[model samples]
Target: MTKTTTRPLAELQADFVRVGALLKQAREDVETLRRLSMAEAQAETLAAELEAIKRQMDRAFADEDKAKEDAFIAGIKDVRITEGDQRDNLIRRTFTVAVTRTGNDGLRDWETTAEKTGLTSLKPEEYAWLLRHPDRIPASILALADDPRTAFQTYFSSKKRGYFRGA
Candidate 1:
């Protein structure tokens, strides 16, 4: 089994504060080095070092935000708003997923194949007629339309959205 240790919230906050100070000092150092008349090779080395530190700082901030989001998600479930002030800025945690088509079967020229398969043969008039007469629409299509999950899989994508706002 893997061993685990938990630190107090105070310690976590202290660690972040120390990291912030280190990032501030590293930035100052980079600015000071920029002011100096250094050789090209030396300047490149310093710039690379600064860039690495900046990446680390970015990761640190991202991790911190993730932790905050996790905590907020856990805490928000216990709270509710029956009635409250409208001016307060409500904060919330959100998650999203992205999907991209990965098949590489020369799909760029699929229109011709689709048309030949009668997939794209339906015209605006046919669609309007279908809408006017739902009974004519296929049972499968009607069933899928009634089911959000199936309809989402067939028509929508993997993109997700969420936001925090006043009620």
Candidate 2:
């Protein structure tokens, strides 16, 4: 023999509602997890792409810098050759002048200094470049002058005592 049990209709209806609510919540949780996983994957892909772009940009910048440096070196070499030729061709002249300075004993002393002429004939740019790069000036040009700066200043004042032509 078998026995069958039945609950009240109102209680059975309440239990059905509770079970349906639990199933809906579980489905929503599963959908939320699926969306989260997809977002994480997309983020990883985007990050890899960003890293590749950064590397490419760095290489491009390095190439640009190398090109600029090469051009600058070539230009400087050309200028050096041209200026050296000009300096070599000049007709240099020399004269003597008295330079007075305070001695260690707090007394003024005078000394004869040999100065070069004809540097005033050089173009301004040529003179400026020679001034900036003293080593590039020919040894003959620097021989009598005190220094590159003083040698280049001859261009500004040719009337200075020892600088007169045929003097």
Candidate 3:
């Protein structure tokens, strides 16, 4: 291109004004992008915080429900001792099996006798095994039983007057 002569002062001023307007538009775009990015980051942070709060609320709800259930169970202690199914679901057969493996024939004998007698199992022999092998039972039952050491004793004590203890 041919070199032009120097522009008039007014033309130079107009060129500078156009350049300034372009620079200002570029700056406005950058500022808008920055604000959008920061807003996105803030929104992500808030979402994460809300998720944490939801988890906490779930845990608190579970704890509250458990406490209410415990209270409800604690209030119903009166047993009228009638002739019905005294099911013991808490006791597990693992205790009896462990006892059998340990060569404690007493528990095996008791299991055989229970089957031989007219005993239709409603909840398995877990409770009976726990009663016989109280020492070896799981720690989860520690608070549930009347006495971890003498749960079987208490059970046997509650047996019919004319009934003999296990074999």
Candidate 4:
């Protein structure tokens, strides 16, 4: 046997109001979660777009630098201009691996000597490291650090902002 129960009209209405409030809160929570998910998706998309823009910027800068270097070299090689500065050109200091250009056996000799001396050949990272730790380096090896070579570095300048150049 089961007992039956009944509530007064006012009580039932109160119950309905409480249940309705709970339902409403649950609906709001779901909506909030959906919005958060959408925002995350948007953020991910934006990050990817930003990365793509960075890659494009890097490529554009590299292409421009190469073009500038090519033009500078060609001008010199073709004797169109001697070593001098032009309108966007400035004399820039640079370093190269201390190796001789003394004909066919020169490169081989350098490699052998470098290996025998336990000296890693000057690569980009090695060169940067050398520059960074100048204090730790000895004078003999340091003297091999060639005089700053002159390069026709290209650049632009404007009154509004200032100078701009590729690395």
lDDT tens digits, residues 15-116, model 1? Answer: 999999999999999988876756687889989999999999999999997676554333121111121232432212121211111223565422111111
RMSD of 1: 28.7
Error of 3 at 143 (Å): 26
The per-model lDDT (C-alpha) reads: 0.45, 0.55, 0.49, 0.45
**Residue 103 of model 4: what lDDT?**
23
Tens-digit per-residue lDDT, 1-167, candidate 2: 89768898999999999999999999999999898879988999999999999999999999997676554432232123212234322343332212122223357543332333344444444445456567766554465369877654543354454363443
lDDT, model 2: 0.55
RMSD of model 3, in Å?
16.3
How far residue 50's Cα lies from its native spot in candidate 2, in Å, is 6.2
Model 3 local distance difference test score: 0.49
Q: How many residue pairs of model 1 clash at the backbone?
A: 0
Estimated TM-score for each candidate: 0.25, 0.28, 0.29, 0.29
At residue 123, what lDDT does model 1 achieve?
A: 38
Q: In model 3, what are the clashing residue pairs, if there are any?
A: 91-126, 91-127, 92-126
* Number of backbone collisions per candidate: 0, 0, 3, 0
Residue 86 in model 3: shift from native, Å? 14
